[model samples]
Target: MTKIKTHLSLAVAISGLAATPAMAQDTWEGMDTNSVRGEVQQRYDAALAATQDPAYISANDPRYIWASEAKAQCGIALGYLKSRTRDEVSLSKCRMAYDRMMDVPRPRPVIAATPPPAPVCNRELPGLIFFEFDSATPGPDAAEIVSYVTENAGPCNWSSFQVVGHTDRSGSNAYNLELSQRRADAVANLMTSRGIPQSALDTTASGEESPRVPTADGVRELQNRRVEILVNN
Candidate 1:
């Protein structure tokens, strides 16, 4: 696989400096067990009215699709509400719509795949390390990882490694990005203190914009907050 250079773009680098909290609630609502068809329809319409992006439309409106599916499922329950009631036909129709919509594939958000490991460095062995949340301090976990790089340094002909920090999609993009950069710098400092040459290390940060786990905003997935080391020989 081609070696990947791990570095955050300037936009991300700047954005990470300003960490902000996530919005408390999603604007779209009505996905409830007790929600009626009309309520679901209302929420869907509202969501559509709120968006101006063409790309948003091309990707089937998630709110409407979800509402439609909920209505269908509710129909099945409504059908069974009265075994001998007169609303059987209506209930069946609801179930049918739900089944059909469920069969339709919804558009999934696109995400970039993880890049391959960087080529071995010439002076220091190349390796990657992960850090805990909101902290630049390297815990015991990082020691073994650092050791691996040092052990293999000669054989791999590794010279230097770049530490890239990342955060989950929780706070404001700008803040998270800055935090990530700091985290990367912290890791780099640790390596240097442990006998790695200062010239053999570089650092960068990518705030919550680039996440390992594509969770919704403010979910705080640990996997998303981490650092990646890229070796350059």
Candidate 2:
């Protein structure tokens, strides 16, 4: 009698499994982790309804029992797998955001070295022309100095000339002033004769106000009685 009852139970379980829709088989494939979990739960519920056996072992088929046990283990493993995936995705996004916030070094501007400024001509004639005591006239050797200035003025790039006259303090201030003016005038005339333009020449008389060598009130200094020529561009 017990054997007959077991056979009847097996026959009834077989009929129920045969009636199960084909869509339930392999439904977990191509599903996301959540979808797979939901499918497994649905299958277990359906299997439970078909039989009274708690192990869901129907028709003596071990596949259903295996699937039931596998699903439980899969649920735990899927939870940890999903957690790791979420953390990895978040880490990737954070790294990208940090890179965007960082400053990218740009190419620096190439600075060309600046060439030195061209030399400007601000020079004086090579030598000073000295005069005799109380004399405004040029000595014989003074012609050579004048010639040197006139010859090199254009080549030296001199744009203008300044002729300054000086004298010793041996004479009265008024007489010295007049003598200095005469001396400047003489130099200016000589420059003009040598082809220096009158427009480019300037003349001044200092008398005994500024002397080359300091001396007593009535002292005569040969260096003080002189004319200076300056060139400027």
TM-score winner among the candidates?
2
The residue-by-residue lDDT of candidate 2 on 1-233, one tens digit each, is 45335544543442233212342244334666666445434543443332223223222333332332233223222333344322222222222222222222323433776444222121533335667778889754456556657766776677688888889899899999988888887887888898889998889899999996678879876657888887756
Off by over 4 Å in 1: 1-126
lDDT tens per residue, model 1, 1-233: 12112212321332232212222132224343344444334433433232222332233324233333334223333433323222323333344334344454656645776344332332321344445556666544466556656655555666777788888777788888888988888788777777778889888777887775578988765556677777865
Residue 220 lDDT in candidate 1: 60
C-alpha lDDT score of every prediction, in listed order: 0.51, 0.55
Q: Give the top-scoring candidate (lDDT).
A: 2
| Candidate 2 segments whose C-alpha is farther than 4 A from its true place | 1-122, 125-127
Give the lowest summed-lDDT range of ten residues in model 1: 1-10
